[model samples]
Target: MKENIHPDYQPVVFMDSTTGFKFLSGSTKKTQETVEWEDGNTYPLIRVEISSDSHPFYTGRQKFTQADGRVDRFNKKYGLADENAEK
Candidate 1:
């Protein structure tokens, strides 16, 4: 309820590098870079490495790990007959 107690919340553009997806929202984050948005106005540009547009879940590029070969490698190195023996 106090006047001038909160930081300024201005229009911000979050740019996703992988997909070139820009998200416009109100935030208090400060930035020195500016870019013209689709709204024909310049705002602080925040560059991000990953976003939903390029993420594995959304783009279907997820990776699966297989431990089947790891078990054999461990047994061969440690000379253990039972690979799943107690540590």
Candidate 2:
């Protein structure tokens, strides 16, 4: 409620490189990079590696792995398994 006490809130563009998804939203984070949007307007551009578009959960490309096998492999490599203990 104070005057000039809050940081500037402006529109920002977050770009996901994996899916080429560009999203415009408001942010208070500071950045030095800028880019011209499709509408002939310039906004702050933030580059990211992943977003909902390319994420496994949202895109339904989730991978299933055998965790037990991974544990066995890790134990074999590091000699962490107890040889005297029952399996």
Which residues of candidate 2, in runs, are more than 4 Å off? 75-87
Error of 2 at 20 (Å): 2.4
lDDT of 1 by residue, 16-71 (tens): 99789999988999999999998799999999899988899989999887666987
lDDT for each candidate structure: 0.89, 0.90
lDDT of 2 by residue, 1-83 (tens): 88999999999999999788998989998899999988999999988899988899899999888667876879889989768
Q: Each model's TM-score?
A: 0.70, 0.73
Listed per model in order, the count of residue pairs whose N, CA or C atoms clash below 3 Å is 0, 0
The alpha-carbon RMSD values of the candidates against the true structure, listed in the order shown, are 5.0, 3.8
Model 1 lDDT, residue 40, Cα: 96
